[model samples]
Target: MRVKRYVVNALPEAVSMIRSELGKDAVILNTKEIRVGGFMGMFSKKKMEVIAAIESNQANTPAQPQRKASPQANEALEQILHTVQRTASAVMEPPIVTPAEKQTGRVEQEQSIIDEIRDLRQYMVKLSKQQGDHTALSEQLYELKEHLLEQEVEMQWVERLIQAIIDKQTEQKSEFTKEQIWQLAAEQLEDWLRPYGGIGISSAVRVVHFVGPTGVGKTTTIAKLAAEQTIKQGRKVGFITSDTYRIAAVDQLRTYANILNVPLEVVFSPMDLPRAFKQLEERELIYMDTAGRNFRSELHVSEVNSLLHTSEDSETVLVLSLTGKTKDMAAVADHFSKYGVRKVLFTKLDETSVYGAIFNLIMNFEMYPTYLASGQTVPDDIDRFQIETYIQHLLGSSSR
Candidate 1:
């Protein structure tokens, strides 16, 4: 391998210089700008410095004893030396000519640079083909180009995150059987919910508290669960909503409670939560829907925490929307994790086109999904946590 650096006034000139010196097999390693002192101390030029390397197959070939007076090899060496010297001299001097002459020179320089790049690309392709590493080299070149294009520092952080995920998936690929995939997903969910322990339904009546960020369908999800348990399992269901902050939110849950003929309690504070639970003691399943507040707001989170901590056995399912960015979803999960959230309920699966956020959440935060609500239908729209179904949905294999 031979490494060379060329500093010139423009990219085209630097590229041409590199090609002329390196015989069109050069691989660009790096490029940067530097200030060059010109004729007088008062004048300086911004030059582009390009570092390139060339790999020679001849370097690895076995040397054989040769007869003296091989004029062809000597002639080739002299030609190479002449090209290097000429390119170096050209790089050292700035072009000084008439405007028309300079324009023509620039056009020719650009065409030559393009030709050199094409030749180098072809050489790389031939090398890759000979070594049977075309795919690998192509992928490496693509990654190099991507890195070069990403000039933002934040992009480097994003790249690291993507790399970490790819590394984790690659490491676990061998252990990932269809059954193991399900088990792994379930275990991840169990881990996320382990802090809150199992869902408690000990008393004659059990109260499950659902609290999370706004627009996560906490009220509708609670209604769906209550309806499923009451209508399908024949369990007595009671509904309580603390969404008095919005009249429309209160009306929506009240309408659902009325249709099911289950008593609904509307509460507003931490003190109201206990009273509401006490009033629904006769019911077999009690679902408490709290007001959805901004998880990003410290004051709102603190308020929700005060209200939710009223019951030790209450299962606070952190409802997150599936239609959000991965980072935003993770932020939401992290923010709600502080409120003693045990399980996660991912909603609005039908609204999103991709499940990258879900994959990221499960892989990064290890959050277990207790339920996935896909549609707006009461009871029918909700389903128990099934990793296969979630995967199928994410992969666009499911009709549902």
Candidate 2:
């Protein structure tokens, strides 16, 4: 085999390079991300590293017709084994390093490359086993895959969901219609989400703290929840805000407090939390709003976490916005999850059509969803999260 490696900006670029140099018979042995250039590890550019190879006899052959069926499992296994052996051989070679390369963290880069190669080998094997006769799947299954992917659901979750439907088809010896496919998807999603579903803020907890990144509508969500406690439940509600970083945030919550006739206390730091709680001691339930910072940074998350110290029983809700990117929301969730913040509330639901981020965050972080705030209307727009409703939003209309 003739093996070659190309580093390019994307997979498409690498494909073009391989096609021209390695011929149509060339198969991708591995592909991974690598950082190319940087100043002391501060501003590196991301690049893709693709390794491809072709059989010696076929390297000079004319392009052949593309096959209609997926490659046989045995052929895939043989290719993966060959690649693994090649990788092992490469790893055993002696290092040929220069002084500049040593200063550039060449050793670390080499280790990263080795790790990527190992991951690629395992993934190739998984594909060989899991993706038998990929083209033979029903159109409904393909549509389901496309829909979930478009919704930004994680790839592994989508695969497992589709696999479940495929297993059902095998047992029944029949293909599912569009409606049946969507129904099965709903059932599967509900089953996965059931354990983390239907958990609202605890009534027994005297205080509820809302924390999240800036611009996620934390203060607005607090107002909504507080209105529900004060108006509907008739509980003596109080507000304590540590969001003095932004003058408008405190003013916003204070305005809501005034309208609802709930007393509002402002605390500048953790030390002031005691005084604020003492003032609201007579209240049945106190809602604390923390300053929304870039919680994606661990320092900011820890800074907010410090303000949560209290003797009263309290639960913290990691408030997220539907309009935010799923990856950024996951980062915020990951930071709060470390501090034992398991309950979540999603806001700005009406602003975005996508609902997969809610499901992704809940499933990935094992979080209990508390409420979904869909509109600007206080109390009326926010409701206790229902799995059925969320799944419906996630799947959308199935009339097609």
- Candidate 1, residues 1-400, lDDT tens digits: the string is 8777888665556655664566444566655567788777558876767787778762333322223424774465445444543443454454777898877786687456455545544554354333332222223232432432232113433344334433545797642333433334334433433443333333433667777777888888888888888888898988888888877998998899999889998887777767887888788777878787877676777777777665435566678887655666677777777665546787897787665565555555556667778889998998776655554554332112
Q: Which stretches of candidate 1 lie over 4 Å from their true place?
A: 1-91, 94-205, 397-400
lDDT of 1 at 276: 81
For candidate 2, the 10 contiguous residues with the lowest summed lDDT are: 62-71
Candidate-wise lDDT, in order: 0.62, 0.83
lDDT of 1 at 329: 66
Score every model by TM-score.
0.57, 0.69
Alpha carbon lDDT of residue 365, candidate 1?
59
Backbone clash numbers for all candidates listed: 1, 0
Candidate 2's TM-score: 0.69
